[model samples]
Target: MKPLNIFYAEPDADRWFKYDRYPRRLIRRIFRGPQRPGGVMMVAINLMKGLDRLNIPYRFNDYRYINKHPEELACIIGKPQVLFNREWKNPVLFGAGVFSHPIDHAKLFEQYPNLVKILVAGEWMRDMFEPYYGDKVQAWPVGIDTLHWAPQAIEKTHDFLIYDKTRWINEGLPQPFIEPLLQTLNKRGLSYRIIRYGSYNSDELKQKLHTSKAAIFLCEHETQGLAYQQMLATNTPVLAWDKGGYWLDPEYYPHRVQYSPVSSTSYWDARCGLKFSGHDDFEATLDTFMQNLHNYTPRDFILDDLTLEKCALKYVDIVKSISE
Candidate 1:
């Protein structure tokens, strides 16, 4: 069989437009071996690793060069805009969705059937898009690169950690979500640091997390929430919101509630971390998380459930199904 052709959009200046579906450049980490920092890049790298293990012949290229070559069976990651209003032999959209702004699917899909098959990182995403796209959407979790994110024999340096995006302060989570958590941490007299998503590269972040006891995650919404999984991969437990604000009523707490493509909860398993609705029971939740932190084996959970090899096999299966 011929190899699967994979195309990813090149990171460029113009790709950062208001509602473009291109990948954003996160922190660049100087790490040796099979792991890099960015979530999207890591997904690509792990997929490549899976293909290599299976001896599958494949080519990786920038989406810009896709039209320059002859048409054939191929898989596209990143932006699907390039494939729109055009024709191709067979195209697969892996981990594709709108990240920033709303999409007019009625107009876009009506214009061109660019996406033939689609794979998402979570079941919730599939549920949200399936009604509009029909039987084309499938749930395929992008598992973690365990080798790069596994736990180590390191001493704990801080009592707690706050893992979040830098944009949360400005755009995502406002004072309603932030102030209560900060007050709780301060009241407990815990030594903590807020590590923004883009602030540190993989190696740097790994080092910080290795020396931390626990983490609290704040984000707008998550399809897969790779960063939270990465923290879990390091055996550091997390406390995160259980529900997406999009489904919640706007009247009760309108400050941080925002729209999202899909509703997903990533860091609220009993074996990994804790969950909270709002400031109502946050203190109690924190108390429980702190009390049960030592018993949680989050790294083991990732190893068993979300390994890259497992995810790759699923990807291969989907490709085979679609190809056949």
Candidate 2:
């Protein structure tokens, strides 16, 4: 049998998934009919690339939410043999299923319960959901676009920039640590300029990641660290927190990527790139970050790790194993 046509929907306007490019490439192969939104990135990105690789045809039903037109979305989903979600009309196609960070699982599950095949980012998360949705969990970490992620050597450039839009403060992340991080920058005196944004637009955020030095992600309630991969694609490092491990890639380190342990939440391990739990310790972390900044190159991140072909293979597995 041929592939299935999928209609992927990412209506999270509040926080765009920033996955436009991915869907475009994936809608090409193994598609016989319409496809619906699967879980988060692992499923979404993989399926998107699978279709794209096989040159399978598909649809992008983004209008479902952006335009508030479920009727239009229904039409786009078209008729299929098996729908990905029960809520999805037939001949419906389901990719992996829905996935969210630790904090948002309950709410997300409530909203998209039909979302089957839950995909997780880290190992622990797979365990976390084993009780609630046992045997359905799959570790689908983020992938990087070597071509798009590569620093154009000219796309954009900045020295040691930390950009985050999350209201970590309002979320009780504390400001004591932040002060130290800033102070470390001040003491380093490298003129490290920090960039930040208020709105949560994917395009705007991607632009920031593509052009900045590194991402300062302090979210204590995140699902996956797809954003970190996006930043790595731009040759940027990441200074992330442990509260978000379920979402962040475990490969993250203190050089190309540094993270905090939940226990060490009060403090960050200062390393090649440096990780600090509190901004108050920023002075110390920033001091190390500056001292070793030049040595911590982008190559350390391995931006080319996830290739389209490999991702396509994973998709083939899902499509082949579907409950035909």
Winning model by TM-score: 1
Where is model 2 more than 4 Å wrong at Cα?
A: 10-50, 53-116, 155-157, 168-177, 197-215, 243-274, 279-283, 297-304, 322-324
The parts of candidate 1 lying over 4 Å away from their true place are 11-38, 62-71, 85-87, 97-102, 107-110, 166-176, 247-264
Candidate 1: tens digits of C-alpha lDDT, residues 1-324: 666777655344445576353233332222344334365556667787877766877878644455565455567655554355246645545454333222345343455455557666677666656666677767777677888888889999898778765233244555545777788889999888888766677777788889999888776567778888888999999888654546332332246433343343642357788887667888999998889889998888887788887777777778788767
Q: Which residue pairs in candidate 1 collide?
A: none
lDDT of 2 by residue, 203-275 (tens): 5556656666555655453434444545555656556544334223333332333333222122112321445
Residue 256 lDDT, candidate 1, scale 0-100: 40
TM-score of each: 0.78, 0.57
Q: What is the C-alpha RMSD of each candidate to the true structure, in Å?
A: 5.9, 11.4
lDDT of every predicted structure (CA atoms): 0.67, 0.45
Return the TM-score for candidate 2, rounded to 2 decimals.
0.57
Report the number of clashing residue pairs per model: 0, 50
Q: Which ten residues in a row are the worst by lDDT in model 2?
A: 73-82
